[model samples]
Target chain A: MAILKTENLNYVYSQGTPFEKTAVRNVNLEIEKGEFVGIIGHTGSGKSTLIQHFNGLLRPSSGKIYLDGKDIWADKSQIRQVRFRVGLVFQYPEYQIFEETVYRDIAFGPKNMGLSEQETDRRVRATAQRVGIPESMLEKSPFELSGGEKRRVAIAGVMAMEPEVLILDEPTAGLDPKGRELILNQIKEYHKTMGCTVLLVSHSMEDVARYASRLLVMNRAEVFCFDSTAEVFKRSAEIEKIGLSVPQITRVFNILREKGIDIADDVYTVKYAKEKILEYLKSGGKLQ
Target chain B: MIKDITLGQYFPGNSVVHRMDARFKLVITMLFIVMLFIGSNTISLEVGFVFTAMAYLCSSIPVKLIAKSLKPILPILAFTTILNLFMITSGMPLFQWKFIAITDEAVETSVFMIVRILLLIAGTSLLTYTTSPVALTDAIERLLSPLKRFKLPVSELAMMMTIALRFIPTLIEETDKIMSAQKARGADMDGGKIKDKVKAVIPIIIPLFVSAVRRAGELATAMECRCYRGGEGRTRMRQLKSGAADYVSLGITIFFLAAVIFINAID
Candidate 1:
């Protein structure tokens, strides 16, 4: 079942003012349960605006957002409940970490949900462990932690809520390569272990290609395409036209294909590209 | 939701007001404010109103923009008007019940005070509306250049003001971002009692303060890297100059002040 869906969502900034702008328009999308979806777009492509709608951080000027085939906005009193069900980890999540201790920081969300002290502690500890935060560090101040550690604690704070649908906007931004891989892998592990729906918004095509089962391409405030990872990569030319490139490995394969080499166009990662190149070299392929 | 603030917003235009020297404009604004206070009767108030209207017209700024500028101060205006209505005592009483008596003089004073306050805001808003913040700060530094001989850091003070003005919108944006992030984590900003609402702001304020300090530290380092020393022997990219229009504007402002003084003396 589609856990979250939007029909023709539209948003305008400074609505009546002379500086008014239509940020997101006519955006239609659906996310099924237990599916890891990746959203990719250039800056100012309405990616943030669209994700903001998923958690009700922003209301559409027109149209509806449905969660579990019911309107999320049906009951004004239940809007806060909807936010817990759809946890959104915004970019630079570290800025939102305010608790004196990492443990208290992680417990903030669950406590807000009115969970019992024991239950909140259990969930906070479980989430901290899940995100690989050391037990000793949980008692330390969030401000005293390193940048990457602070980020993990912040993500764990939302994860402690155990939302049915998780949305992370650029979770790996400003991290070193190892930090990036660790964070992405932790998110993938969480999705797998919890069997929850995940949506990752990223600028790096390679990151999306490596993790997401489905890809939703947004260009200029509209969905350019939404399909399986392999299917979306097939339209690499159209994606490139909008000032976004495909995965680096996919670009190399496209170059090889242009030279009449018998390589698959859908090879997006380095590991897959390596296998394809080895096969081509062994098959008596001539260098052009 | 906090992005709707229009405080200190500068509107760009190419009218005579925009072209007037910033220092001259600042001086005129001060004179206009002084004139607002000098009025003692209807005649001087009328003169002040006409001059303010003429200044607004010459700026070519839309009337709606000036009205919008007053949006944030409406509550203050209402409160002051109400307080004046209760405090003033003179003339025929309209309502008398125990300690609270609304008199004709109270009514008159309230209306006049409200009008004076609104006109004060509108007239000063004209300076911000026409002059960009950068130009305004530059003009302030130049106007205060004489204080440099007294060992005052005029340029440094102006630079601090410039950075503060530049960052108001940015900090507001950061606050909005932090609030949304916390809201996503189920930090309930709404649907709370008075105590709960104030308590809920703790999460918001902590992060905001931390980020503001971080930004300040980063900005300080950046300034140091750019070799930004104090006002000593510093040169500006945009130099302040007084032109024919500036002289004309100053002359008109002086004439208006003279008229206000004459009306005050006669009244």
Candidate 2:
């Protein structure tokens, strides 16, 4: 069954005012259970607005969202329960850290879920360890931690919820490459172990191509394409025309193809590109 | 939801009010506010209302926006009306009860009080709606330039105000983003007891404060990197100069004030 689904969703921000804008329009998507989906879009492409609807942070201007085959907004009073099931880690997640200790911060979501004290503590410690925060550091103030540590704490806060679907919007934004890799690797491991749906929203094409099985591209407030990562990269021209570029490795492959190289043009990550280049060399750089 | 705040929002336009010198607009708005209080009778208040209405029309701002500007002050208006209606008991009682009376004078005073406040807000909002904040700040600095002899930090004050105004929208945007992030964590801000409601807000407020302080530090470093000193030797891109329209508008405002005072004197 589809763990999360949106049917003809439309969202107009600042509606009925001079600044009114149609942020998301007629976006239909069904995210299957345990799917690692990557979402990519240019700025102002309604990616943020679309993710907010999944957790009931924003009610659709029109249409509906269903989680586990049930409408999220069916009962207005049950909206808070939906947030518990769908955890969202926003961009600059570190800025959302508030509790005095990193441990308390990680426990925040589970506590709000009304978990028992022991259960909350167990989940918080386990999540912190999963995110690479040492036990000694858990009792320290979150504000006293380094930027990357604070970020892990913030992400741990959501992961401790054990949500059915975890949505992260630009989780690696403004971090060093090492920090970014650390965070992404943690998320990838969590998806693998928890067997939960993960929607990774990112501007980095390389990161998404490596991690996500499928890609959802947004352009001008509508879904441009939703397909396998390789299939979407096959139409790199159309994606670029919509003001979003494919991964650097994919671009290099496209350039090689334009130069009359008889190589496959769907390589989206460095690892895949390296393998493709080696295969071409082994085949004497000629088509059999 | 915080985007609905219309306070200090400037609407870009080429209307006469938009063209009027900001310094002149500032003086006229102050005079208009003074006139609102100086006027004692219905006729004087009516003249004040007409003057404010004319200014509003000249600004060319949409009616909905002007109404939005008035929305924030609805509580203040209610308080003023209630205070005037219940406190003024000198005249004949229209409805009398034990230690509570609605008097003829009380009814008349509240009417005038409400009208004065509505006109006050409408007249001042016309200034903000028509004039951009940068121009307003420039006019303020220029107007206060003469106070340099008294060793007052006029330029510094204006610079602080400009920074404050510049960051209002940024802070509001940050607040919105943080609130969404916390809400996504299952932090229930609504549907809770009073103590729980306050506790729920801590998640939102601490992050907001942390981000705000970080931004301030970043801004300070950026300013220092750009070789920014105090406002002493800073040159302006657009100097405030009065046109013929500014003088004409100032003349009309002064004349309106005089007429109101003159009528009040006769009454």
Candidate 3:
């Protein structure tokens, strides 16, 4: 089931001006329900521009974006409803926090949805817990929190709305490795617990390889590939040609094979690579 | 909705107007303004219109850019027209309501004032559109270099203007990004009551100010890293030189000013 999709979408910045640029051109996309999809592309490859159109933050220059079989642009007046259905957390999403308290910041989206106060409060706490924001810290001003805490509050702001699809653009940007891992883990848990579609847009190969079940590769304003994670990583050479690399472990495995070691070419993550190497050693080099 | 600001925006072009020295362009623009004011009667006004049209044609800027300059000032233009319509009483009155009256002279004056304002904006916009900001600042500094005798920090002032103009687009982009982030979280900026709209802007304004302060701090550090020691011994890489085109433009402007004065004296 395609929960959110774009057909023949085209987006041009500063159109009709001398500064005109086609950021995302003639791209079609389909996102399924409950699929953790990671969009990978180098900077300015139209990753941000493309995801912005997913939630109607930007209107495409041409073609259609359909959310659950309904064209989002069919009625301009109702476009805001699309944003509520497909929530977007922009790069450095933490900077958007503005309420007096963390709780208020988290409740902002649900409140805008016009939910009852009790329902908004319930969603806020529930989402906060999922995002690992402590209940005691909810009373503090969002400005008073540390950077990582502020990030969690901002993500919780959108999560409280419980959108059918969540799209986060580089949510773990500019964080320590531990902070990055913690947030990624929580997002993975959220996807499993809520069973909602997740679209994580990132340039880091490792982050997506570790979490996303599917991958959407973008190159120069077009979709390069949209396939299962294993299938996409198998085309590491093609990915590298477009200035995007495969996971480091995948590269190590590829190098091992080039050096005459019979290692599986499909290994993408460190843990899986570890398991594969251990199994190969235990099997005493024979295939059967 | 905030992208319509075209004021002081430079469009890169290679027309003779664009290639002429910026100092000459600045001097000519002021001379043109004086000529516009000197033209008092219908004959000189028509002459002034022709002069402006010639300048526009030579500049090769798009006709639509003039309309862009007028879009944001619609309210001010309306106010100017309304104020001149009833406030000044001259010639025969066409409509009268107590103290409020619209005379034929006032109508003519209103039309003249509106055209003058539009022409003034178009003329100034031509300077910005044709010349880059770096060139404009260099021209300003050189034009005011004589004031250095009085210890007036001419280079510093010019540098300030340069940086300010350079950062306007950057700040606008930052504001747009911040607004998008907030709007994604459902900040109702557009469709709100007057009070609600103003209230909604608080989120945007606070972050913008904070980031602006941070950027200033970062800029100071970056400048110091490059061993910037003020403008005391600064030498520019591109020295300003008055070319043949500059002299020709000056000659044409001087002729137009003389023509406007000649027309006014005859009237």
Candidate 4:
């Protein structure tokens, strides 16, 4: 079954005011279990608004969001149960960390879930370790940690809830190069070991190209494209037309193909580009 | 849920009231309040009300927004009315209870008080609706510039007020976002006991406070990067200069005051 689904979704912000705006409209999407869905959009393209609905942080103006084939808002009394099943890690989530210690901070979600003390402790430690936070640092204040470490604690807070579907909005924003790679690799490991669906909202096309199996592209509050990574990249021209910067490697390959180099067109990642170039040279395909 | 606040909000327009200098508008609003209090009798209050109505007609702002602003103060208005209706016993009694009584003079006094209070708020809200906060602050800094002779930090105080006003909406937006983030973590923010409601608010408030402090630090650093030292030698991009519009507004408001005072003296 699809882990999450939204049909005919519409959201009007600041309704009945002069600043009223339709942030999202007619958004139809589905995420299967264990699928790594990448969300890509320009700023103010409604990517944030669309994902907020998955966890019931926002109610759609007109539509339905079904989690595991059950409407999330069907019974308002049990909506918090839906929030537990679908975790949403907001952008720059470190700002949400407020507990005195990292351990207590990570346990906040589990405690809210009414877990026993021992169970909450177990989940907090396990999640902290899974997110690459050192066990010794768990007793220290989150404010005392570096920016990247604090972000890990914030992520672990949500991970401790152990939601079946994890959604991160710009989790890697404002991090240095090495820090970015470290967090992304840890998240990749977590996804593999937990076998849960993940939705990573990011601005970097290269990052999305490297990890996501399926891609969801938004433009001007509409779902422009929703397909596999390979299939979406096939319409690279259309993606670029919406003013999204396709990955640098994809642009480089596009230039090569234009000059009669006769290389395959689905080169989005640097690793794939390197393999294809070496294979082309081995197969006697010469530069024009 | 905090977005309903319309206090101190500036409505954009190009009417004569909006075009008047912010300094003149502030002075006129102050003088108008003094005039309203000076008009103690019915005839003087009638003059004050007519002048305020004329100002409102020139402002072009919708009365619906004014009513929204009054909504939060309805309890106070009602309480004032009740206190005046029973507390005063000088005139002939219309209805008498053991100690509480409603007299003709008391009823008239309540109506007069309510009308004066409503007109006072309307006149002041008109000034805020016409002038943007930035313009108002700039005017204030200029108006208070003479205080610098006594070593008072007038410009700095005005700048602080302006910055504070500028961030009210930002802080409110941050609060809304933090509330949603905590609620997504299964924090029961609604349909709970009083203590439970307070407990749910802790998660939201702590994060909002942290973010606000962080933003303040960032803003200070940004200002320092731009080499902001003090307002002593600082120049502005837009200078506040008085013109014919300013003088005309001053004259009109003074005329309003003179007319109210004359009516009160005759009464």
Candidate 5:
């Protein structure tokens, strides 16, 4: 079932001014429930604007956004309810952390939802653990933590709300490889355990290829393609035409094929490419 | 949503007003304000109005932008109109009720006040619309350089103004982002009791404050790394100069001011 959807959605920034720009245009998208979908695009392709619409942070200039078969904007007064159901973590979320301590910051979302103090505390601790924030650091000021730790706490702030659909815009941005992997693994585990829809907006092709089951590609304020991970990677030439690239491993396979070697062209992730190479060699597959 | 603010926003253009020296424009805008108050009668204010309209046309800024800048003052306009209409009872009574009176002089005085206020806003807004903030501060620094002998730190003050103006759009964009981030977390910034509304702002304000301080620190560090000590011994890429056009513009502005003074003297 489609849990979050946008129908013919359009958004324009600073309309009626000289600086006016159409950030998102006539985008019709459907995100199924409990699916791990990765959204990829070059900068200024409306990835940020599109996700803001999903959680009611931005109202579309035209068309509608439906959350769980109901128009989220149908009742403006109840928009906050929609927000709690669809949590959005923005880029550089660490800058939004302002509470005296990590625990209070993570509990902010739950408290806004009017949860009891005890329940809010419980969720805060659980989310902290999930995001790899230690129990000892929970009492420290969020501003004092390292960049990676602060980022995890900020992510935990939204996770504590336990929304039905979580949309994170560039969650792994400005993080080291290990930090990125740690956060991505936590998100993957959260999706597995919570069974909630997850939409990860990213600029890195390898990160999404390793995790997301489906991919949505955007270009020039429009949906370029939306399909399974392997299917999207298959159109690497088309993706490249629009200033985006497929995974390095997939490009390597494509290059090997072009060099007169027969290799699996669908290899997108490093692990899958390794398995395919070993299997082909054991089967006595020879270069052309 | 915060982009609706039109005040102090510069619109790039190549009109005569845009090309005029900023220091000259600043002084002329001041003279224009003074001229507005010097005119006592409706005819005098009308002259001031005509001059402002001509300046607006010369600036080439869209009429809609002027209307937008006037929108925020609508309440003041209405309040003054009502106040003047009911308070001034010197001339023939146009309308009279139990405790309210509207006279011919009231009508004239209200029109004069409205015209004077509108002209004041339009004249100043034209200056900002045509001149960039950087040039404005540079002009201010040069104009106030005479006061530096009294240890007024004129250059430093102008440098502060320049930095403040530079960060306005950045700070506005940051505030918008932070508001959205908090709103997504269910922070109710709109539609609540008075106390609840104030409380809701805490989330947004606290984050905005934190980020603003961080940005300031980063800016200071960057400046230090670039060997910025102070405004002392600093040279500008584009020096403020008064050309022949500036002198002509100043002459025309003085002529208008003299016209207003002549009208006041005749009245």
Candidate 6:
């Protein structure tokens, strides 16, 4: 069953004013349980606005959102309950860290959920361990930790809620390559271990291709395409036309295909491209 | 909802009001405020209202925007109206109830007080609405330059004012983002008792304060990198100048003030 779904969702900023802007218009999509879904779009493409709807942070202007087969806004009083079920980790999550100790910061979400002290502590420790936060580091002030550590603690705060659907908006934004890889890998591991649905919103196509089972493309407040990663990569030209480029490996393969090379057209990662090239060479295919 | 705040927002335009020197606008606003309170009779108030209306017309700003400026003060206006109606009784009674008597004097005073408050806000809001914050700060610095002789940190004060005004929108946006972020983490901000509402806001205020201090530190470092020393020997990109329209405006304002004072004496 789909863990989260949006049906004809629409959102408008500054509605009924001169500055009114239609941010998301008639977007419909579904995330299967335990699926790692990636959302890609350029700035102002309404990607952020769309994911914000999944957790009920933003109410739909005209449609409904379902979490675990229930309308999130069905009971207005229980909207916060929906949020607990759909965890959202915002970009630059480190900026949101404020507790004196990293442990307290990570416990904030579970505490707000009215969990018992023991349960909150257990969840926080479990989440911290999942995110690779050291036990010693959890007792230190969040400000005293390194940038990457602070980010982990912030992510753990949301994870402590043990949400059924985990949504992260550019979780690796502004981090070094090593830091980015660590954070992304940790998130993938968490998703796998918990069997939770994960939605990763990113501007980097390569990152999305490496993790997400399916891809959703947004352009100008509309869903341009929603399909498997390989299927979306087939429309690389259309994606580029919308000011977003496909993964570098996909571009290289597309170029090779245009030059009449006998390589698969769906190559997205560097390792896959290398293997495809080796296989083509061994098959006595000319370089063209 | 926090993003909808338009208080102290400046609309950029090439109108005569936008072109006036900030210092001159400040002085004129002060003079206009004094004149607004000087009117004690019906004829004087009428003259004062007409004078403000003409000034408003000359500013070329929409009257609706001026009216919008009164939004934040609606409660204050209502409170003052009620207070004046009940506290002042010196004429023919309109109604009597227990210890309170609604008199014609009370009615007149309430009307005059409400009008005075509205005119005061509308006239001053014109200054902010027309002048960009940077220009206003520059004008303030220039006008207070004489205070430097008394060892006052006029330039520093103006610089602080400028920075504060510049960050109002940014901070408001940050506040909205933080609130949404917390709300996404299941922090409820709506549908709660007074204590519950306050408790719900803890998640918001903590993150907001943290981000604000971080932003401030980053801003300070950025300023330092740019070699932003104190305001000594600083040159302005847009210098203030008094043109024919400015002189005309000043003259008209002075004439209106004279008329109001003269009318008050006659009444």
- Superposition error at B141 for model 5 (Å): 0.4
Kindly list the interface RMSD, in angstroms, of each predicted candidate in the order they appear: 0.6, 0.7, 1.2, 0.9, 0.9, 1.4
The DockQ-derived docking category for candidate 1 is high
Index of the highest-TM-score prediction? 5
Considering only the true interface residues, what is the Cα RMSD of candidate 6 after superposition?
1.4
What residue pairs clash in candidate 1, if any at all?
none
**Model 1 chain A: which ten-residue window has the lowest total lDDT?**
A279-288
Name the lDDT value of residue B133 in candidate 1.
97
Note each model's CA RMSD in angstroms.
1.8, 1.8, 2.8, 2.2, 1.5, 1.6
Order by lDDT, highest first: 2, 5, 1, 4, 3, 6
TM-score of 6: 0.96
Candidate 3 DockQ vs. native: 0.62
Kindly list the per-residue Cα lDDT of model 4 for residues B48-86, writing each as its tens digit.
788878887888888787887776777878999999998
Best by DockQ: 2
lDDT by residue for model 6 (B1-267), tens: 676556688878778888888888888888898898887888777777887787778788887677677888999999999999998979999999898899999999999888888888888888998999998998889998999999999988998998888888888888788888888777777867999998877777887888778888998999999888988887777888888877887888899889989988877
For residues B34-115, what per-residue lDDT tens digits would candidate 3 score against the true structure?
9888788777777778877888898889898888887777788899999999788979999998888999999999999888
By DockQ, is 3 or 4 better? 4
Worst 10 residues of 2 chain A by lDDT: A279-288
lDDT per residue (tens digit) for residues B115-211 in model 5 = 8888888789898999999999999999999998898999889989999999999999999999999998888887779999988888888988888
Q: Which one wins by TM-score: 2 or 3?
A: 2
User: Tens digits of per-residue lDDT for model 6 on A1-288?
Assistant: 788888999999988766789999998888899999999998999999998988878888899888878998899888888889889999888877767899988988998899999999899989998889889888899998888888888899899999998999999988899999999999999988999999999988999999999999999999999999999998898888988999988998888888877789777888888898889989998776
Q: Is the docking of candidate 6 incorrect, acceptable, medium or high quality?
A: medium
My TM-score estimates for the predictions, one after another, are 0.96, 0.96, 0.92, 0.94, 0.97, 0.96
- Candidate 1 chain B: worst 10 consecutive residues by lDDT? B1-10
Task: Output the better candidate (2/4) by lDDT.
Answer: 2
Chain B TM-score, all predictions listed: 0.94, 0.96, 0.95, 0.95, 0.97, 0.96
Flag clash pairs in model 4.
none
The sequence of per-residue lDDT tens digits that candidate 3 reaches over residues A1-288 is 699888899999989876789999889878889999999998989999999998889999998999999999899888778889889998888777778889988988898888999999899999988989889999998888888988888889888888889999999999899889888998899899989999999879999998999999998999999999999988898999899999999998888877888978888998888899999989786433
* Residue A46 in model 2: lDDT: 94
TM-score of 1: 0.96
For each candidate, the alpha-carbon lDDT, in order, equals 0.91, 0.92, 0.88, 0.89, 0.91, 0.87
**Candidate 3 vs candidate 6, DockQ winner:** 6
